[model samples]
Structure formats: structure tokens, C-alpha cells
Target: MINQDHFSRLNQYRSMWVLVFFDLPTETRKDRKAAILFRKNLLDDGFSMFQFSIYLRFCASRENAAVHIKRTKSRLPKQGKVCIMQITDKQFGMIELFHGQKETVPETPSQQLELF
Candidate 1:
């Protein structure tokens, strides 16, 4: 059993995640440039690319996740589709992945850089 304070503190660490899945057109030169710029923006904003068109980041709370989602929306290109989802860490952990015909290792979310 856990005490009230300990339990409350544990609950403070909400396991929320923000995932950005995008499908942008790259057929034309302008479309390709838009896609590349979108990708770079995500990286610059501390999101780690999970796959070719998927990215994920962990957040301390739902509000923090919302801020990222809003930012993503503001930067979306007018030519493609972008979706954002917030899921619990447990749900994320349940995802199964395979590379080609072999199973692949799970990805650990990237940590933020710290200044000394």
C-alpha cells in the first residue's frame, strides 16, 4: 500500500504522449519543399521521428500535449493531411512493430537536451 502523498506524487507523472502522423504530397517541387520544411519544423520543436511520416513525443500532461498539437496545426501546409493523437504510455507500449519479415525493437522516446 502507498501513502496519500506518495500516491499523489506518483499520479503527478501522467503518462501522456503526443503523436504526429502526416502524409504530405511530394510529387511537385513545391510540394516536396513543403514536406521537408514541415519535417524540419517538427524536429526543431523537440519531436523525434518515429518512422518515415510519424513522430512522437512525451509530455508531462495533457495541456502540454495540447500546446504541441496547436503549434503543429499552425505550421501545417495547405496541401497535405496531418493528424495528432494523444495516448497513454501503456497504449503506446502495446504497439507491435516489424521491419520487413523480422521483428524490431521498441523505440524509447527521445530525452530533451539539458544545459549544464
Candidate 2:
């Protein structure tokens, strides 16, 4: 059994979101290939495509988020700019999304059960 207070506290403060934004050059065949591979690597690492050039993943904690950040750095392409940002789950929940002119609710992070 899990303590409700502890679980709520973890979700409220300890959880994190990792967002990666990149602008890679694809002027040549090799460049395009590299960009494609980079996207694939991110997908394999559990990142979801938030946009064509932006990927985001939810981590159980800041430590877990750091590991994903390091993985993202290791696969960065040599020809473009890549930025990674971390935000708490609380901050992420405050994001307001929209489509066209209508306001939309931000996506809820997928539930991730962590052991230890």
C-alpha cells in the first residue's frame, strides 16, 4: 500500500517535465538523415512530439529528468541548436494551450508509476 500524502506530494513537487527544442539544418541528404535519426532517438527514449521540432517527456523526478537530458545531449546533431528545459509538474499544469482561436486545456501528463 502507498501513502496518499506522500504520493500527492511527489506528484505535486517532485515530478518534472523535460522539453527539448531543436532547429537542425537539413540542407543536404546527410543533414536530413541526422535530423531524422535524432528524432527517432528521442522517440525511443519516451519523448513525445509536441511539435515538429519540439519533444517532451515526463519524468518522475528531477534526477530522472537529468538522465533524459543527458541522453538528449549525447545524441545532439553537430549542425544545429538544441535546447533542453525542465519544469515542475505544477508549472507544466499551468500551461494553457489553444488551437486556432479556441482555448484548450493543456495535456495531462501520462501517469508514471515509480518504484523507490
List the candidates' TM-scores in order: 0.80, 0.87
Question: lDDT per prediction?
Answer: 0.83, 0.89
RMSD of each: 3.6, 2.8
Please report the candidate that would top TM-score against the real structure. Answer: 2
**Model 1: per-residue Cα lDDT at residue 89:** 66
Candidate 2: Cα lDDT at 29: 100
Candidate 1 backbone collisions, by pair = none
What C-alpha lDDT, on a 0 to 100 scale, does residue 66 get in candidate 2? 90
Candidate 1 residue-wise lDDT, 1-116, digit = tens: 77998765554456678999999999999999999999999988778888999998887667777888899889999898999999876676677889998888787876765332
Most accurate candidate by lDDT? 2
Q: Give the TM-score of candidate 1.
A: 0.80
